[model samples]
Target: MMDWRTKLLDPTPHARRDYASLATPVYRGSTVLFDDQKAVTDDWRQADNGYSYGLYGTPTALELAARIAGIEDARETFIVPGGQAAIALIYLSYCPAGSHALVPYSAYGPNKAMAEGLMRGLNVEVESYDPLIGAGISDLIRDNTTLIWCESPGSVTMEIQDVPAIVKAAHAREVSVALDNTYAAGVMFDAFAQGVDVSMQALTKFVGGHSDLLLGSVSARDDVAYAKLGPIYQQLGLAVSPDDCSLALRGLQTLAVRLDALEKATLQVARWLAEQSLVDTVLHPALNTCPGHEIWSRDFSGSTSVFSFIFSETVTAEQVVEFINALTIFKIGMSWGGVNSLAVVYPELERPGVDFGGRIVRLNIGLENPDDLVNDLRQSLGSI
Candidate 1:
């Protein structure tokens, strides 16, 4: 008989029966068991072959990846540590040293930071263009230009891009176009249909609707894009926790209902703010006042939680802070896409020829009663 300690250490321990559940099991593992020596491998493409190592992903992570790919109609999807990691992976994969890339000035602040910091340090020139540059992007492309990034209804400033035009221009130059589809939750916008080569999302927001997890997805539009991203993904070891994947999976189930309710509530709040005396503009893409509202209407199927609004020039920056602080229902926070409302003032927010002067307030509407939220905003505006 085997020694008691040896038995305890047995890797082949078995349970009586596996529970048949509708939910995907949280597969926490690092080392995968192989049937034979020849079967041993360390491949990231588990969906195509078989599980090789946990550093790529366990079954839980792959399920999330597959589902995201299915929803986005992507050729394949890579689950990474966070949205920023996804961005980094894509950049490193596409932009070799001496290569040039284009990113919108209105992209997520961190993306621009990476372009200015890391990509610059690596000798890759990432140029910033107007989000609405459209087909005019052709004028910016050069022989070394390898990538173009589009972030629709861009971060905080909320400029919806002319993705189709940008894609057409980039393809004309044989350059790849990538999109930050986080605001669309990977579903509201058809990235593949719009000719995007890769689409990425911060699943932490809408997909992990409770704000309880941090995850991101990079979906390749075809075999070519997938082949380009896969090796770099493996090299970076972009492993995510199965537990976080589980939370994202749960978030996906309620995503539709959450998005619908958020749209209605957010529109109500945004429209009300538009009619107010102190408000200069509402930056929600659904509103005609937004910079690329027509493009948003044409390209996007829907909008999700977050958007921005600017206070009139008469309002002081300090007054904006006071108003934000006075809000009871809308909590002061940075990230959005959760069960609770969030508000923050971007005092130093900059665009080419525009200065918000800290008067730009971005809001992430939650699943709260619109009436209560409006009342909260009404009371806070009065405080200012």
Candidate 2:
């Protein structure tokens, strides 16, 4: 004579199967049943051993996290809903109320917005430092400065920061360094080897490869930092869809190939853009014209498909819009790293420290033929 609850809580569906497949199976569940009541009391906080709860991680999430952790050379990894969530988690995990944090002037817009808007309301002091500060960042550090945020190859502007120098300076002051390594997709940059304490990235961009799914990961270099951040990660109740995790895992298998293809295709387009009379400067880090090109050349093993260029003074506002609108091959939209090419015009956010005199256009090179992309650009610029 069992109650209705006893029948409803059965875990018999997970029957053993003797089948194997190349792909990681998607595990989706909210409740995790145990053999005995005492087993329910076991520690399920970390994903090292087995399933805890769906919110903590399922096999799908753990597989993706392990893969990202391997590339990042980190002790553990946590998956979040999106890149911004990863950024927020790092900020909140380190900077308590009344603490101070330093953010780069060229950081992702949402990151800066969170710091200025929410973190400020919580009594945390958020300050912006120049991307070129490098080791000189020591001067900006204060007694209560608990965290320092770095975004190499600043979003849209594409200015590479001296990560090692900044990390060294931060470590000396007993401060933690967290980086938005989204542009590199954690593959191009060896964040941990370079002394980054916490490496956070948007898996939506490159790791997902396709623009279909959105995901993010935060990896810690050591046990101490992971221990400090783990509780906060759980408290935030951050969870990713198992379907998205499966897609990300699939995308990772081809990451190296896709990244290499993107690098080659983007450089061709960027170099061609630089030659245009209407183009003022190409902001690709691999190019000598970009700021911190030397640092990029030294630290980064390769480049990505995303970069920005400034239009020459001769180009008019209407002309800029006309050129972007006339492009037949490149789609006018936001977000990169998808198989489809995309472009967007940034009308002077007036981001601090860097200046784009004329209209700035950021191109996300796709898997299209470089010749076709160049032809599209030529026709558009010629029409203007």
Candidate 3:
């Protein structure tokens, strides 16, 4: 009874919606139809109830969020566009206008920039404190101190922080603690157990296991934190593509094995670099040279592949460039956590507490063979 056009135009069509697969299905759409008008009164911010809006999350996004929450051992998680966006979400949610926040001096460069720029513009006072301050941070706390930002093992310089001490101090003043656990990837460090109010990570790094995608996640400790952060996250309009979420979910499947390999490979390279004539000191939390090595040893269960080394004073910037450029396997790049090895030189590190008087280069050990990577480094050093 129906023509071809009528058949095509009919909105009431059915397909088997339930099918078992090895991976979570990616559901992409902007509009989610409600079965009844009463559902309109339901909150779209809560992803647990049912389908809401695409911007809030698709099934793929929610799947990734659930996995990240499980990894973090937190109650709820939110996925954002990138790692930087996660930081912004926390800052916006907690650090209200005219409030104060304390950030580690050795935090990621962009986080520092955010504090100095947007946070400042919002009439918030962002104070930079030494990562090793520990309980001494209590001195900086004020009546308006709303949040404390911490980054362990200083992403670039590898200065481990006294997280428990910082947390105790912050909680004493009723301030919430937000930690950047990207380096640990929620495995090495237990953020929730350590009393962190909010745990955030760049899924682009170890979670994605490849440099191809950029995604970030924020996990809230309990219902109160979740309720507070959810609205702000929605207002920020942070949305990640379903494809990126699916890729991140896939990356989670092998995260354990990949991280183990990277850890073993990185420590081997770091030890070798420490003994090299061109190297002054290696900045790795696993090594004694790092500022808070003991703290890291006590708090963290494992180390990551990314670490930095400082060249001896005798090694000039030009020589450093020559050495880095001479490398065959390691590509010159910025971000890490990919299958391919990466190397970068930070000529002028503005970190105050720590000092790397000479050229500083950060290496991200990938899935490459340790022997081959060492050989490449030896050859590069010979060239310099």
lDDT of each structure? 0.94, 0.90, 0.91
Instruction: Give the per-residue lDDT of model 3 (tens digit) for 85-189.
Output: 999999999998999999998899999999999999999999999988999999999999999999997878878888989999999999999999999998799
Q: Of models 1 and 2, which has the larger TM-score?
A: 1
- Cα RMSD for predicted model 1: 0.8
Provide the TM-score for each candidate, comma-separated. 0.99, 0.95, 0.97
Over 1-384, each residue of candidate 1 has an lDDT whose tens digit, in order, gives 889999888977498556798899999999999999999988878889899999999999999999999999999999999999999999999999999999999999999999999999999999999988899999999999999999998999899899999999999989999999999999899999989999999998999999789999999999999999999999999989999999999999999999999999999989999999999999999999999999989988888889999999999999999999999999999998899999999989888998788899999999999999999999999997
lDDT of 2 by residue, 1-384 (tens): 988899788667675787799999999888877767766743335576566577888888988999999998999999999999999899989999999999888889999999999899999999998898999999999999999999999988878999999999999999999999999999788999999999999999999989999899999999888887788888889988999999999999999999999999999999999998899999999999898999999999999989999898888767788889999999998898889898888876567654554389999999999999999999999898
Error of 2 at 360 (Å): 0.5
Kindly give the stretch of ten consecutive residues in candidate 2 with the minimal lDDT sum: 41-50
lDDT of 1: 0.94
Q: Rank candidates, lDDT, best first.
A: 1, 3, 2
Q: After aligning candidate 3 to the native by TM-score, how far in Å is the CA of 221 from where it should be?
A: 0.4
RMSD vs true structure, all candidates: 0.8, 2.1, 1.4
